[model samples]
Target: MTDDREAIVPVWTLATGDVRVPALAGDRPMTAERLTELRGVLAALADEPIATLEVHPLSDKLDRGRGIPLDAGSPLAQHLSQLITQSAKSSSVAAKATATGENLYRMVVPAKTAAQLGQGIVRPMAAKGVANGIRGAFVNSKGTIVDAASFVPVGKAAAAGAAGGAGATAGVAVAGSAALTVAAPLVLMAVAVGVSAHADHQRQQAITRITELLEQLHDQKLDDERSELDGCRDAIDKATAILLDQGKLGVSLGLDSAVHAIGKALAAADRRLTKWENALDELPEGKAVEIDTLTKSFPGVDDDGGTFRTHLELAGLAIALKRRVIVLQAVDHAQSDPGNPFENFARALKADQQRLDELESSIAGVLERLSALELTRTNSFRPVLTTGEVDRLMRAASRIRKLGDGVMVNSRATDVAIDIARNKDGSVVVFPSQPA
Candidate 1:
């Protein structure tokens, strides 16, 4: 018997970790090398023959503490919640990682698989050609796999009679949207009926492979940002503990120093946010002027690409710092509220999460404009543009684009999940729990 509780399918947790807040790479530039590493990982997943890929906001037991969710659409929810589209020619699944940018999810390329089956199935033109001919016939408009032949009756000559009948069958196979919608679920359920054991085995293999791929990924910048965010979380927790212990007597008990500590942390975060805002504000918007004019414009990159790299790096750092600052701001707001610290803090997570979204939107808008410059052509015919300058600009634009795409914050904070309870003296105790 198959263990229903057994996770036979692989679940790749792509997250920035801790505090359950929306954040990108903090204090690090997402360089071209970093972006290439990210794409390489996705390309590996894209090669997998995914049975069914579902993207959702990853939530850990800690995130849903005492039935209260910390996510409240803060981290990965904003992007993963968007539509995941499947590529007909390839097994690549693309998702809107940000409101304005698209990122690859996971899936398989049918064409690639068919090429591998060349000699095994038949001659060069037989198997490969057949697969190519029916490249997208199996997927519905929503990218769900469906049985194309299901639209017609089985074992009936009249259903596929010559000329008109065959033509109708092929048409339904290719563009029968209404019929596919009604039949897709039935096909999936039927396919899932008795393959539990096989599915479990495939899942185990996938998990192992994905784990290996993740281990191979090494981004020092992302690691540094994770540490910084952790420090910020620790700072918030420190203030929270003080408030819980002292209650209204915090000032009289000589613990008022904790308020100063909180202020310091908040100030540091604010400074980072201001720096990023000023730098980003300096970037020119693409829609503001003609593409030709934008290309001719110089936003401060030197011939060696040094200045452009600095700007891209700062933008990345800002993307990360901005997110952490949002959390700090929320905590500051909650701390000022004249209510239970625990309740107020939890409410602030959801209430103030919108700031993170706004930050992402602003970054995305700037990156979109930069992208136009990268794509603009500058040949000898257009003496106004140079190849070397455009190359440097392209590198900067690409890095900023990746930074603005936002990091996929995986749900792995259960270990840090804290629980709050009332003591006999009406005081509150926040303890960690290892949720099952």
Candidate 2:
């Protein structure tokens, strides 16, 4: 048969001797490294993954009447609560501890198996509790004492005397004293329980406050994102309008007509040059020839002899003339090549078109994000955007506006005029000048 006893887990053991008072108020700030170390130690004892950890210093001292006072807001009380949480996470045991009215810490770790009931928990506690500065005993759920420790000698004697006098009254009657000393320890125990209850209430209140603050921050972030999305949409629309107007102006200026005329001229010149080259290729080859019977019939011809050697030379002058014509045609085509009227404008337009496309894509993405955020808001879920993403969107919008303004200025066209204005709310407004 399995034992139905609860297992004891060690929560925290205070350092032996005098308890050190924590320096809560000091110039030294808490560093991340120290916090990490503390978190590691607590997590090890808890034996469970820690979701969150927080620490707060006690602003006031505990009441000293009930031994070591374990008030709700005291640092010692908070530490006790931490210990209980740690132990509960590690073992099936449920426990609570608090500071006594005498300013001493006390905890109860339940006894488990037969061997653990006394040897595992009780004996070790009895031997180590006093050295650890703990003034109370480990008790089971049945109110059975597993082990006890006392720092004060007087308290120990009173407790022993109380046990001896259990049958008579409630505590040992002191000789020559009307009041029983054993009553003091019993009052201390009662106050510790009350303090533990109060501490629990305070912890709950703190948790609720923290939750509310986080919710407020989340809502604010959503509001900021919505505002940014509106701004981005406005920028995209303005930029698109500017580019369209510039494109129209370019067409009206006959810039497109000029480019078309030049293209036609170049094509015609190329065809004429090709025709001349073919004609030059078809010309007959030239050769040198000698006529021996020469000109015997020519009476006026100089004749050292009737068969005197006579040479005739023929060169391809027609082919050379055709080649010269082709060269002239090529030069004429080059000189008449009307360059693009709005070279800079064309380049800017291409770049702006690409940027415009990107802006549209970004707008779509942001809209999807906004829709998701809206759904989360409707469902009362937390929605957040990173600071970097927000900044990137803002920068993109700014660049689009600047690029649009540059295109208008560089176009130098009298048809389009950009105007900047400010509303009463100190927000900037951009618009095109109305034609009179």
Candidate 3:
């Protein structure tokens, strides 16, 4: 017989080397080439069938870069705690919430913030002051008086201004229009123009791919949001009955929190759903873009009359279908027996947790590797973060930690099964579980 523990999700360590968080790219600030590379990487994942994964919550946060845990709490708990602590420290107090009540302990922040108001404001401001001190050391980046003698050289500024006039053009266009340009005769000047033109084509290609992917994701989000709305309505409906029921003893103290949570969760879901609907609604008329120019400008290219676009649409549709079907398929694959939502949700959650951990490691790796040698680099020294950002981050971490501790995890399902299994066939099977 298979052991109960055997089916439990495996919690792999998140040491520095254990999980690699691929560098973020795409419509972000990373260069078009860099962004395209990243898109290819992430797109590969999005394109493929998601692995049969399980996300077992770690019982503790990994210490430093080691896979060793901070405590018995899950990595999700640590991630949540970090998120909470960081948010608590942010200047905009309202900005730190998980928006939706993803965790039951989200409510504790108002009380905690009020309790620790003094350090909440002071530490962050101090951190900002230190950061500004360092940033002010730079001679190039805009801010108050430049004190950073270590910033860019004077002559390079002119060169950069000239280069920016040249390079920034394509970056801006790709960031928005994803325009495809053409180069001059084969030379340095030609190379610059050709490079920009090439990037523009790739940018359009990526945008088309991503926008299409996002649309599919948006549909899934829409369904999920609708599900969220339904859940909220159900919770509120139950709470409404409880509120009206004078005979329901000991319900007020408990039910009030539940109702409040349901209301808050519902409102957040509404806000996000509205945002998604709005974004989806605003999709630009992509048909206006001229892929024919790229086909003609390059010697080996062929138009094929929107065939690539057709293929993109078809791929997007297929991906959407896969996502719709996969949750069911993954569940079927994971379950030792068929048709269990709790097991499905649990296993899916476990895999998500692993993925989230991987993302954290990836981000942290980038942070810890910044160097003074970075000073000599011709690349613009955009601060990876803004001032007071650390305090906000720290507070978020703390809050996530608190949230982890607040909620209890258990199997009401197992309890029910145990109850049913104990009763004899002919005997009165007294319901051992509460008749909610």
* Top-TM-score candidate index: 1
Which is the leading candidate under lDDT?
1
* Candidate 1 lDDT by residue in tens digits, 1-436: 2222211111122211011211222222233233334323432333221111211122222221221111212111122221111111111222222112221122111222212211111111111112211111122223443331111111100111111100111111112111111111111111111111112222233233323332443445533433343333334334333332222223343223433433443344345445545654565654233333333333332222322333333333333333333333334444354333223433454454344344434434454444334334423466666776577556645543443233322222111111222222222221211111
Ranking by lDDT: 1, 2, 3
Superior candidate under TM-score, 1 versus 2: 1
Measured on C-alpha atoms, candidate 1 has an lDDT of 0.27
What does each candidate score in C-alpha RMSD?
A: 23.6, 43.4, 30.6
Off by over 4 Å in 1: 1-237, 240-347, 350-357, 374-404, 407-436
70-155: candidate 2 lDDT, tens digit per residue? 23432223333333333344323222221111112222211111111111011110111122112233233344443321111111
Between candidates 1 and 2, the lDDT winner:
1
Residue 142 of model 1 has an lDDT of 39
| lDDT of model 2, residue 245 | 21
